[model samples]
Target chain A: MTAMRPDLERTASALFAGAPDWTAIAESGLPRLLVPEAAGGFGGDWGDAEAVLRLAGAAALAQPLAEAMLAARLLADAGVALPAGRVTIAIAQGRVTDGRFTGSAPAVPWGGASDAVLAAVGGELLLLPPGVATPGLSPAGEPRDRLDWQGAAVLAAGRASTSLGKSGVGDSAASEPDLLALAGWARAAQVAGALGAALDLAVDHVNTRVQFGKPLARQQAVQQQLAVLASEVAAAGMASAAAAAALDAGGDCRLALAAAKLRANLAIGRGVAIAHQVHGAIGFTRDYPLQLLTRRLMGWRSEFGSEGAWADRLGALAVARGSAGLWATITG
Target chain B: MVAVFALPPFAFPDDSAALRGDIRAFLARHQPASEPAARANCWAVADPEFSRALGAAGFIGMTWPEAYGGRARSAMARYIILEELLAAGAPVGAHWIADRQTGPLLLRYGSEAQRRRWLPGMAAGEVFACIGLSEPGAGSDLAGVRSRAERVAGGWRLNGQKLWTSGAHHAQVMLALLRSEAGSERQAGLSQFLIPLDTPGITIRPVIDLVGNHDFNEVFFDDVIVPEDALVGVEGDGWRQVTAELAIERSGPERYLSSHALLAALIDSAPQDPAVVRVIGELVAELWTLRQMSMATAAKLAGGEDPVVEAAIVKDLGNSFEQRLPQAIQAVLAADLDGATPLLRCLARLLLVSPSFSLRGGTREVLRGIIARGMGLR
Candidate 1:
């Protein structure tokens, strides 16, 4: 199908936008979207997840929607019973000693607020209840805390034989990179949404806000800047969505994630500069709605890794393929 | 408020892979002998024999109706063939304009007789065509065209000049825009005529480009006469016709793939240096994203909708990507002007000619203006 189900997308958008609560989200089955429909989940693929995350980002929702969806996936892989209320994931190896978990997971999204955290230590997967956290604020003022679990009660624990991370690495070991890729992909999807929303704001402002006897859009310079910004937004959104499609198809997931995140990250400053430039003084104000999207764009751009980190990873991959294989790697 | 722009993932046809394989096989055998440098801007370089071979293999006018020597294929299938040709740097200049825009325009706007006259020969790749939109003072400002065509006995008498008519010397027909309605001006009272290049009182002279290429020409029409049926679509509808035609003109594989040869050359020449690798990686990421956007646009076209905004977006961004590619490479990698390496030569030639990338088809400013208008900007 060339189009997404607009009815389902509208429902997801309604559920995720503007401070949707955990009970509402859980009831809507938004988090369980990745799980199979036969298994009582929404039975959506990664592309669907990409669409929801974009809506969440466009609304600049403070909840850990991405993490909750990811947690459902990890728990499904581990054959753990679905949890009630909010869930989150930490792509770190927590220490497991005699059936209890210890150690801290950094930058866990809404970690203190989640009902449970899906984590792994060594080769074993573990689902632990929410832990006490020293919260750190994201650029958007959202909670991304250093969530500390000191022998926290393990709700469930087991080995996921074939998991998301295992495909990147040969063994069934918990590979941090692939897990991080999943995280990066979610952020990339969110960035795409945020950029589009931001561009809309900039376009509206340019059309309405006037100076020198005409709307700002009447100026050639303004049009050029907005055009470039629009292009960046389009590129970022497409890259992220395509990556989700590639990941769903089980084809070159790592490269897709890397490219998606790198492009999304690179698009941020270029877009922010134009959007803020076009909006003038009001865009820079604290009370303005434009800051919400721009700040989240900044947050998402840095979350998985910096642009340099992704560029380095992607570059090393191209080098391994060599000159001749590079084209095949990209096109194939 | 109108919904924000969104580009969903393109659902390619089920046979995309098989089609791609077939094109690859065809290209490997039918490819002409040319310098490695020729592939970078292969779409502009003519190879009549190669075009004939492609036609014989049933690649030209691929999506046209079977009655016109076409296979009656899907537009997606044609997109695959186009991208494959571009990726491999195949020279497609001989019939590119005809196949890409002129044929499609005629199929939409031409009389049945006109279609019967040109469609078969074009499908066979034996007939070539060029666009005659820009005039002496009408580059991006096409509305400023001063060319005039007067109604006459059994025909229309045309007298005008068109500049930057690419492939005019090699083409059999010229789709020229002229001022048709007397005393009318500015995007009104204009008409398009499918004039034969060999018509009486017509002159085609070469206009060499910065790269020393003679693909461009100045076409002069001094009282040239054509049958009344030569007017495509309706009189005084050239403005609307050409605007619609630009969607086809700007939204093709050529926008981004013109310099693909240089990208391949860079990859072949690059080392394991981190700086170079980082550059290449960013390039790859951007290219991949652009491919997605372009494919989405193609899908829109294939679905029988002329996506004005999407097509402009493709060209606006695609043009920037191609035009900046060579300079980006040369900044990271040193190249001597006298260097004989493929990468070095591609870089030099591309740098010299890349300025035209954004200028041709539609200028970046023009594309952006169209996009801005589509966005509801003032």
Candidate 2:
């Protein structure tokens, strides 16, 4: 019998049901894809990471899985001692130094809300005190806090100059394929979750709502609309899973990941529009989760990058090589 | 082996792979006459031996009941078989209409007499079928069909012309949708009938396609007489029946895989060009996405759900990709062709066949209309 990973399902279901104390779930059940056998982690591969991220996205989790994965990724990149839970690592645009890591990073996930901050001081990893809040920074949600503070505790200090790589992650000297793969899977998963939610909402609404004395679902037109949504969700889901599996297989997943993100962004945007149409006037209000799903979809459309960014990446790839070359790279 | 993208569990059991294997074995054993053209003029082989082979292999009547020598397979299973045949460029043209639409329609709405009379032969691939839907004046506006069928003593008299009838030249019967009553609402007056193509009053004139293939014909029904048993369903229900048939027509992998030969050729004849890698990658991704959507729709259709909207969406996206293939390939080959073009010939072949991608089943605008209506915007 085939079944979904229990840990991922548990974490996602809890988040979807609005579980308040999600951190416990995240700590125990999250980052299963990132934690390795050597570091007391799950020792799971990118396929596991993709599955977890998909569940997380489907559940619309607002937890710290991404942040922790980011931390694990950075630690793995730096080849340093990994920290226990309660550490949060985020990317900033500038450098950090002794007893203080200073830089302006906006819209960090779980930022301003974490117990600790790992800043890339120059090219070296530096741990900063949580109190060193950067003022004028705001959390996108209630669980996050953004602030600006003076010089704070710098965990691994005294690196004269450090440089983050082109991808804006630390460890400039070496490539971080795992971390990049995580970002790709994470973004794809979130889009999957949002798309799944939109489809569910639409299906539920049409099944119950009465139009012309018949349930909307009975109408051929309604059925057709739901079918469209279902197809998009199906495609997006496949793309997400393919991206994850490629990463697990240690193959070049950049093409798969980009395709997944691009498809997700486009599909979810279309899905939300259809959801609203099916839900009618009630879909527009804040009382409904529709607004939240839509906002997150819009946000995630440009989170790691937007549709345009991925399209450009894909287009550039096609232009750099030929169409046949691109197809072979993706399929072959 | 093609890279299999992750998919939702097979929605239903699909024997398409097996179907393909069976069909391939049969095709190999009974290869048709040699054609000077490329690949039997793009799988247009209408050879009787090939058709009889498929019928003998129990590969025909994929979705029909076993009562008429049918298999009672799900649509998804049939989809797999058809897709494999089409993608491999098999000469399935002889029985394409019978297997795809007419047989299923007959099963759904044809009288028991009609089913017993026609389906067994169809299942055996002894009878070829063609569609008489599109007319000289009405292409997309199917409701405006003017092929009038007047009530007669025994059955009816059909007098009108059907344009673009693929396989009509060789078909034994044409399942035609025509207006039975004059001066009524466009849809209310329509009726469908199964008329033998060799009837005295029927004439089929070849209308060669762009590839100079006689696959299509202008089928003219000038006072053609048909028995009452030829009526497909209750008079004035042709619109409904036709719409249902459109669902069968549009919701399949064939809608997207029209250019698959080009895709396969490009991969097969791959040159060691660096830029070719990038372009092929993007095309592969698009094709993969389209396949997923097609598979999902197939699953829904197999579940006895009407996936009209989903089908429209798939057809739309698939057509876009098909039409874009020429541009995508040309962009890559233009620079190289200027230096030393080897694949230009293949690209040219694709360009020649690409226009039908958006035209054959339903035009892009028609699909968009259906999609808009589905979205409740119309």
Candidate 3:
């Protein structure tokens, strides 16, 4: 299967090129890429949508494109009518009693700005209207609002459909497409993209920045550090791509996504350090775009699941599989 | 913007599974049952008998020409065999150097007569070789090699000392790099010689490593005489040839599999503690990722691409993972240790040998330097 869509890629880059142009993205039909054509949306699969997510990540696009795509897929899967504007998903833990949902989801991506919020609660999908979330900002200054739905009115609620189970058409095996595995892979893809941006910024900075009568890139110390950073980036990219491919193939991808997120987290820990080290004081400034990508990397790594959480999950799975079956599990 | 390094997702051929199964079955038959500590040696153990068995099984010289007593298999086939041998902690060191590097180097640059004379024996695992690159003064800075080879009546006279040469005492042949001309550029004037360890005036003395093993040696070539055919490739091409060989040497399953025995032991005996599980899980994930990258590099080599940068990346990361594996396990075992378990023994042995992980092949610093240049930074 093709791993890229040039048309969607171009639209994503052009629309989210600078500040997040949410209206432009919506008008360009990019948000409908993951929604089924039967729902008056583009008839694209997850593989096609990954191109948009990856490009949005590489450019450090400040929009909630991944969340919007996930929300559309979830709504479409739940057989709910498409919303008018942007949508985001929150895998919240709450109970639905008497047609009211009461829960608090901290740090929901684009929760305040989105036209609708699709919260997953106990195997059911609840579509909540905007303005229910108290707006907040992540450390990276993105719209990571604290969504509180204490007896909040639900626009639509239903069992999130498993018709797409194991088909690779939707994101996860759970009734909702916004489970940890799906979110982990999505964030891993973004982290991979941000790493690319970091590498680019550092490489360009070192090549152009001069010191001691030569370019800083000529220094062995700087060169070695940059190399280490690049290797981490390469590794994170490979892991993320492998996870995406596994998800697209409808394979058992929990382990792949865990590994990808673990690797991505490790890469961010090393990659951001080296990027700033190579760029020196200038990289730490707010004006530099390097901070934009690096900050997002730090934020995305903790979302869906932290490295520790995934590591625990993966480790438990491995132990359950035992040593004799470990190699086969990994290689198979 | 510069394109990121793309390790395009790829899979091994469908038949790789059968090859893996065959190797597994072969290991079940001939694999040695060593204690946990000795098994930690993994690829460092030199067992000529085991090497011969591997050769007889068509595991060695797999990708070489059939005329050279090779099976003419694919690179992935060779990768499968090597990884399996390494993962099982088998003793394949006797022919590891020749099978991995010297054989390929000869096939690429050796003359027809040279190939006809040495390739068959090497493919048969009867011939063993050790690299002679480092000296007392020049370990990573190879261009500073002080060894000299002067033209004599029927051949050349070699004079120099090679230090920290692994498997040299057990090797039948030594690939020595020497300066054949004076007052040339740093990388110029260097030549490679296929010196027999038994040649006159060559003294092979053991240099024990930190692990109390005699695998390393110091070879003193005091006016040793070698025939004209002992010269590998062409004169003044040693630097280029050695660099090409290193691309293969640095990228392999062996680089990361040194501590795998310990990891397997840990997995087999690990408790269900959440903390321990996290560490083990992280290790497994990293190992899987490294294998994917290494296999991709192998595929590239099979396709005849140099992949120097990619190989260096693998070695650097693999070495880091291997060196830190023991300590990571140690952290997990802090609260859960009972002492004298197989896991403890494996960890103890790994701690001793892990220091050499970053030293052998190439130092982490040197490998990073190569990677930087590959990134167009230098």
Candidate 4:
């Protein structure tokens, strides 16, 4: 797992080297990473998508890989056909009660851009048409699109009381292993990737943009920030990679994913800030790729439940288990 | 009054509760000593018996291959065991360093001979190791160490004094960081040696801590010769090797577990004390934050990345909380001390022990420097 992961990481890095348009790469790469051979995917696990996210983060590629991966899996599970080229998913809440599935998810990711929208409403995977309108205010920006469907079909359902139930779309309320692991894996990997990219961007900026007659990298303050950033990137990378490997191996991937996402979210946010701070005034401008990367990092951190969200989850696990149990669960 | 409150709910799979139950049952079967369980948080109990029991339960060396006596479980599973052990206050102090830190380091960097000889025993908790890093002249400034190991016939003779050698008196071996051959100033020509504690010409004396516990030691080596094989990694690569080792050392729940017992004591004893409540609430929040960072590092370790900086940050923050716990508790109790209150007693113990918080693994100053270096500020 360790040896293979590093090689996959390098592959991701090479794929995103100095690319002008990231949307293309994300559109293509995200699905390819998640697609299983049987379902037209790359036979990938949640871990692979995580690897892709980590790579994208390192390269500072700004696009929605998370949305794509989730949408693809939702479609695959629901037995819905996915668009060959570009697809995104929006997951909102709807009806689910006592082992039965029903309801609708409004204004999903790639609502306009995606050909089909996949959601789990009332314990069922529902492929709804992207409504042609927007939901109210989104924590993220304006809706990517609106979904309008006549009658979406239920492609598949693992179990009625299963975690991927209708209401469990955004996060599996029941801790469904498959979806839960995948979400955690993807977020952690993306955070690792973002940290990696932030480090690179910061390094490049520091090396090229001379300040005080020396590159920013030479400054003690800049160096300290970079040092910490590098550590965070390394840590996040390890966490995301570990989570992915666990998922691939079909072990308990939750705690790993939770830890990875929690740490990566915090690191990515701090990393983006530090990178921009080192870059100074010029980094704030939209023309610089730093801004784009920073925005993505920001968006990703808030996505899949924020830092506080993940932290609280881990803390609850620790506190409730009262140390011994927590330790056993974590180490098990 | 300190406001003590539970952390906000984190939405996870509901089955986490069931999983928690399974872990609890496993721990109960292995080590029934659940009370005074505070010691379990250290997860440093290197007792051969308990470790062997853990091995019997198939819990030790949890991410290692089966050939090495490991269960090869998921990182998460191992994390569960560590958390449980700490909470239970298991006397893992004996094998804590080896299992949590050195075992992994050896697996990653040890020679094949080193792995074959050490890994299995370590997995079974048969051989315990302590880190020998700090010196009287070198506390936070690891690069300033003057300890020397000179070449000799079929071996190397060591001459140096190492202080703050935790578990040194009890451990079978010590991974000592020293100068292999003298070089230009800081961090040059350094090396790490796996020194057998029972080697001739070596003497170890306990350095009783403020609490009068034999937790650390002072060791002197007078022409103590070790086989050439004792050298770990390459000579003069000690700086890099030690840096990696420190990253592992400082990056786990143990870094923050010291204060936890005191915190629990404080909260349980005075859950309604406004001051206690407030302090506990704030500390809990910070603890939550630190866990996020720490867990991420754990995940990274599982993923095979050495997150030196992230680990440093965790240590820095974790140790800070650990150091502050006593004060937080004292202010909460606000009791006039004949120093007799249960809170005061706990506070006193924590105060005495808290100084060791920054001292262990790496001092706060040293860690901060690493953090600064990581942040590109230094």
Window of ten residues with lowest summed lDDT in model 3 chain A: A169-178
What is the per-residue lDDT of model 4 for residues B173-235, given as tens digits with 9 covering 90 to 100?
999989888664679988889998899999999888666677778999999999999999888
Residue-level lDDT of model 1, residues A146-238, one tens digit each, is 788888878887654356532332134324345567778889889888888888888888888879999998998998888788888888888
What is the iRMSD of the candidate numbered 3? Answer: 1.4
* Error at A89, model 3, angstroms: 1.8
lDDT of each: 0.81, 0.66, 0.81, 0.63
- What's the TM-score of each model vs. the native? 0.92, 0.67, 0.92, 0.64
Model 2 has a clash total of: 31
Q: Is the docking of candidate 4 incorrect, acceptable, medium or high quality?
A: incorrect
Q: B1-378, model 2: which lDDT tens digit per residue?
A: 011122342322333446555665766776533321243224345766677787887778967899998988766667666765665566677887898889989888988899999999998988999888899888988787888988899888889899988788778999998999887767788988999877899888999877566777998878888888888988889999998998877857777766665655555554456455556555666776776567777787777878787778778778778778767767776453332433454456567767777787888767766764554432
Residues A1-332, candidate 2: write the lDDT tens digits.
11446665565566556643546655564553465567666666555666666666665666667667656645554555555455565444455445555555445556666666654433345555565444332222424344343555456532211222222322334333323334554777777766777777776777678889987877766665655665566567777776665554443556666777777776776676777888889888878877766766666666555666565565555545553365445433
Top-DockQ candidate index: 3
What global local distance difference test value does model 2 have?
Answer: 0.66
Compute DockQ for each candidate against the true complex. 0.55, 0.12, 0.64, 0.06
Two-way lDDT contest, 1 vs 2, winner: 1
Residues B36-58 of candidate 3: C-alpha lDDT, one tens digit per residue: 66667577889898888878888
Pairs that collide, model 1:
none
Candidate 3 displacement at residue B298 in angstroms? 2.2
